[model samples]
Target: MTVIKNAELTAGNSFTQNQALGLLTELVPVSLNNINGREIQTTSAKKLHAYLGVGRDFSNWIKGRIEEYGFIYEQDYINFDSPNLANQSTESVQIKQWKTKRGGDRRSKDYCISLGMAKELAMVERNEQGRAVRRYFIQCEERLQHIAPQDVRKLRDQLKARITAANDFKPMCAALELARAEQGKLTQAHHYTSESNMIARLVLGGLTAKRWATGNGISGDPRNSMSADQLKHLSYLEQSNITLIELGWDYHQRKTELTRLSQRHLAKQLEVAND
Candidate 1:
């Protein structure tokens, strides 16, 4: 067993090109797992098991695969079973517990396995779903290899621009709220939150900024923790919302328009990412 230094996992900076392409997202969502002080692309073994239609219980299936393949612990995978391990590390590590089919709450151990290990496991399963999953992983790897360093830097620059724009929007929004209050048009004190939550819901698929922050173990603004693609989507919606606000559109109308715009923007971004 390899002793993992800094055995803590945090969110990665950006989504991979494969994710942007929506190739492996539905089948098995990949994330960056911190291991040995480096971030490696990994997927949840439990999710993979479900996708591959594995008949065995999750615990037995995962353990059996690890033992059969001689996978090194803390190298190919890491278990989020020990709460003490999280306390020892400075980084935020969220240990998720789920309810069973019978509605019993259970905190089961989850394994984040490296992409290489996942592919190997998929290949060994020798079933149709397994073969399809393995092929998808291969395609993901191929797309990832094509993402140049300059492409990454471009995305980073876009994220920075969007963040700055969002910060600038806050003061402007406050001023608008202040004017509304002066004219007796403001009905609530949380106008800033309302506007921000509107954009967040549209971009984040109904998850408000506050809920996203709480779920991710993030404090303060959740925008700081968002991925580049997410920021881009958010910034666009903010700008659109500002325009609708100035036009005297009602909340429901703005929301409807923003929802449509978000869908178009996401599709366009996906096309760009694929290119």
Candidate 2:
């Protein structure tokens, strides 16, 4: 992608993983092809030290830089607790970890740097690598600027999906209202609301819809806060509840049946996630 003109430097500090790798390769000849994802850049501390030309005292220097720049661990850089040993030959693993050291038993796997941390390092370290990093970041920022329109479109599509999910919940609410009207009881109305809360908790990972929305930094009805997959799960439960009510099941029977099924389904999902 061609770089856009007049892009802001500050905007370069939030690159996706692909963008970071592209820029890194442009600056240096090293290949960091082992990592996966859109938000992480993993390389050895030794590699970073060599590139920065900071000599053999890189451990202390990096520690000092992190403190001086107020870098947040995991956000700016992740010092992995366990070394990544997946798919490595025995000799290569030994060679890779030969000069790497850590404070405790944890071997140095790699330093996972975010775009923000990389930008700070480029600015703080005055050397050839620093200049190259600065130029690469500028180009990356310019390319991101060119994709602004696509980002806006993606956001709009997401908002539309959220709205559709919110609308889907209205039928369930209406069906419960009808059940209350047929029984002509205030208790039935309250029971349906309680049951809805239970279902929300089951499918939405333990929070009531409103609480989930607030916790996720969203506003408005929590039902609208669900992803498409979550909406599908909730819709299935709601439709089952509506079907049971239509077949003349009382509130107590519907509650007992739905509660048992929801709990079992949630358990299965949890089991799969753990595996």
Candidate 3:
């Protein structure tokens, strides 16, 4: 593209596997019962620590954190009869030694540090925990001296290769992109002498405001960095095909008409979309 002025706000941090899984579950609650948000499989709970970008034993680290929250007490498989024994057996515990639950989806695998971190991960629906085997991406550099780096390096290489491969955005913007694609008929990409271009010489068309209250992400999408009303106004500008001229709209307008199109509107008409 022609460098559309940063086009988007700064991209946030990369997700770890657990974070991705959590986000995926949060984003697609129905999918949690399935796999990859589709009719894959329910038996296999996804491993998310790798998608979250953390060191090896991160699950243990997270579980450790969850344990630290004070509510989650690791009741040793102790013999209540022999209370002196610090460790207990699985057979004796019903609630697994009486632990106060801290932060965790029903399943420990899906749990992450924040409930509002990302869409699929933070969604409330996927917050269920079922006992299952989970996987994590272990970093090679974090390996202890005595451990082998064979699998760690392999995972690192695979993840590096997947960084670009996995960028395939989900269906979130698919509908909008389809709508925009349909608009392409009206918006001829290039027209040397077309009247659409002819009109461009005179009219400034439309605009929302000078400063954008919420400058990033979808309106009403909690994952978005900006507020719904702000995105809604920008959507209006995008719809009107005019420069929205946001608060810090690139520190330049390139032309006076582009500048003059700026106008403020009440932050109303906000609507929540499918999470």
Candidate number of the best lDDT: 1
**155-229: candidate 3 lDDT, tens digit per residue:** 344434333222322221232334445656242334212222222232222211111213322232211222233
Q: How good is model 1 by TM-score? A: 0.42
Instruction: RMSD for all candidates, in order, please.
Output: 17.1, 14.2, 22.0
Ordered from best to worst lDDT, the candidate numbers read 1, 2, 3
Better of 2 and 3 by lDDT: 2
Q: Where does candidate 3 stray beyond 4 Å?
A: 1-223, 242-261, 264-275
Better of 1 and 2 by lDDT: 1
Task: After the best TM-score superposition of candidate 2, give how far the Cα of residue 53 lies from its true spot, in angstroms.
Answer: 53
Lowest-sum lDDT 10-residue window in model 1: 1-10
- Give the better candidate number (1 or 2) by TM-score: 1
TM-score-based ranking, best first? 1, 2, 3
Each model's C-alpha lDDT? 0.69, 0.58, 0.28
Q: lDDT of candidate 1?
A: 0.69
Model 2 TM-score, all chains together: 0.36
